[model samples]
Target: MKPKCISKLKITGTKRILQISLPSRKCKSIRVSPLESRLNTGCANSPKNSSSPLRNEQNNQKFISRYIARVLAKPEFQNKKRPIKTAATHRRTNSDGSKEPLSARNNKLSGGKSSCKNSDSDEKTIKKGLGIPNPDIQKTICRELSKKKLYKTNDTDEIIREKLIEAITLSFKTTNSAPNTSIDFYKLGKQIGNGAFGKVSLAQNRLTGHKVAIKIIDKSFIKDERTRRKIFQEVFIMKKLNHRNIIRLLEVFESNKNVMIVLEYAGGGDLLQIIKARGRLTEDECRGIFYQLIEAVKACHNMGIIHRDIKLDNILLTSDYTDIKLCDFGVSRFAKAGEKVDEQCGTPAYLAPEIIADLGYEPFYVDIWSMGVLLYAMLSASVPFKAKNLHDLHKLILRGKYDVPEYFSAEASDLLNKMLNPVPHMRISLEDMKLHAWYNGFVPENILDLSFNVTRQNEILSKMMSYGFPRDYVIQSLNLKDVNHASATYSLLDLESSYNYT
Candidate 1:
């Protein structure tokens, strides 16, 4: 029998308990790890390391409780060593011939291929003078791992083991403690891009040397609570999404003054720059890009999300220019089938006719309309409807008076007309758009196959624990939706695995 889908699985806390519903086991695994809180989060597949059977509700709750207890207990990280003082400072050459000092812990994490389940669990002794754990020690270690710095890589051997050694020595004194994660952890690089809210910068993880884009939104730039909520909403929606076509939000940190978001580095830049540089692209090339865009939109709509703003500027291309990722969810929101929402937003040129007419519009159809505008712009290098002012633009959009470029083929024109239909009811559905003859020979590459890798999830769970994060912290963070260190590391690890290493 397939793992049954159950609702109301609650993880309780001091304030209130958070609940998550597991999808049916027969359902395909998603791009997200099994431990996430997404719609298709994970199956009820029992943990492989556990011998006790999760055959009923009580057992399932017990598993969650134990997991939570393990994490929330926030136990101090313990390290067991067998006299490696001399070996600690000795630099060893890798097979590649580069030499770097590797700590005993680094060997378990980076040198060897041991799975996380067995990595951090070996018993270690507290020194004769100290047996009681210092409560702050756990936070200090966890904070170091959760910083808003570069996404950590496999360069564990490079981490300053001196502090780790100090902590180990602290085992001899009282419980050991280290500083919380700080900006010092990142090797800051040049500014890369800018947005309405903040500037983007490039940074490399000091340990692994991996590059990441950090978007820092200053509190002063935020005008009001509504704008602040929109930014938070973007983070929320991005967290729920785990598709290849969408940019991964690796980690998030909000301070009293600024909101910092770490994202995948897309060196290829946005679609607007590409469209401007290339001008009018060939029909074949446009179809290729559109395929991915449509797939991204489909993925969002599947999760009942509407990317209220879909335009050339919002589509990000990969460094290789081989793939595109949809981004900028500042105006997105959830909607049900046939549900209508009103709140005139989105770029002027991409607004649907219903929106221009002040009629409450179905969110899905509005997104489809914007996509039509995008497709038109992709083909002609400009929006179909244009005017000197908002009044004139609204008029042109409501009348649907834009002419199809003479260069467009009949099939392309036909599809565009259906998409640009003034009658909202007549707009082509996503299914019809896929079947449209304009894309007769188009094929998408690297199609995502959802296979919930519980092992990978366990591996991450173990890795976090090894770094001093309690397992319960990860689960609780996901449940509470706190965009903090434990959840960030899990998402970062999952994002790393998400990329095609080949």
Candidate 2:
């Protein structure tokens, strides 16, 4: 029989609380309360160490709890231990029909090695049984573990590493805290990435089992009313905007200092990653990606939301390279019908001439100008307006005088010139962009039959992994001193002239 939250089971001679991880794999072991107690503390009492059975059991439980905490907290362990709960712990029975030793399970987990054999328990067991007797201890352990689960760890470097390992072991000791597939709604899995604000985790929806990304933002960094309001506005904007080409926001969860924003996880990572791996994106691929992006931007314009920060970094790719999703709405603004925005905020490299001039202009035009910059970056794997200092960059942007590279096609050049027009009134509108020659026949004839070659995608991903865009485009363009190459003489003008427009 499987463990339940309130179920009583006899393990050896003790009647213990058995809780199964509901809706999880059957082969997974159910943690008794005794085990939970052990994992909470670092020490586990072994047969060699414990003089009496009662004392031994207590030590073992404590050790196990600490061990669990260590394992669950690790990056690698987080991947192995999922949060889903299932009714069956389909323990493989030997011909003799005896239960398998814990070592066997531990070996499997450690890939055939007993790495954590010796441990001390949090509480001394009364006898050789898997049971919980003291209600007070049980309640304490349960509350603490749940609290830890709820609170995202904000430990330092060394502490994070140690705690992760302990957490993994603790996870298996009790099933009460197991993430319910039905209740959790989303299959919360491993931590994919982290940033200054918080982390991005991979999650799967229980209903569809589709992998998604969950970004948990730390509340500590969001200190002021400006930030709180910004977060709320972002959530509101994401809730309203819906498009295939845009990074779809599924849900927003506000818990403590952790604000979890659930989104469609892009397995292929971000365009910036792709570009970093590859010196430059292929012309055809760039065209297709830009075409989709413009359409998405047009949709945003139609919805009255201005994605102020449009760049390669904000674009994420699907597992297959066929689709790209625009993400990171931190600087996005919602304009009321017939209203325009003058707030100047966005990435410096992608800011429009009007923004540089500090002149009030329709925010949508700023988006269009940024789109042009994005296109240039996609095609050449470098920003068009590059300089050493912000002052020079601002001057260049105000002039809007970067020469289009010779590698650019006629159609791309024309589109670039039109979209990047310095005058806000002259920039292409969302309506006109859709009707442009470059995008005229780009719409899908059938949504489901979109062409996506897996082989090509693999090649692209592989190439991206090894090579992409240049990292120091801004630094290099300005001819700044490379910290490592103080004595090396490099000519910036010569390098620029090498790729001069005909």
Best by lDDT: 1
- For model 1, how does the per-residue alpha-carbon lDDT over 304-378 read when each residue is reduced to its tens digit? 777766766667766545566787665566566565654455666676766555435655777777888788877
Give candidate 2's total backbone clashes: 68
TM-score (C-alpha, index-matched) for candidate 1: 0.62
Off by over 4 Å in 2: 1-190, 206-208, 337-340, 439-443, 449-502
lDDT of 2: 0.47
The Cα error of candidate 2 at residue 89, in Å, is: 46
Worst 10 residues of 1 by lDDT: 38-47
RMSD of each: 23.0, 31.6
Candidate 1 stretches with Cα past 4 Å from truth are 1-182, 446-450, 454-482
Alpha-carbon deviation at 50 in model 2, angstroms: 85
**Top TM-score model:** 1
TM-score result, candidate 2 = 0.52
lDDT of 2 by residue, 289-392 (tens): 77677667777867767776676667776554556677766556565433443345555667676554433455566777888877787777677777666556
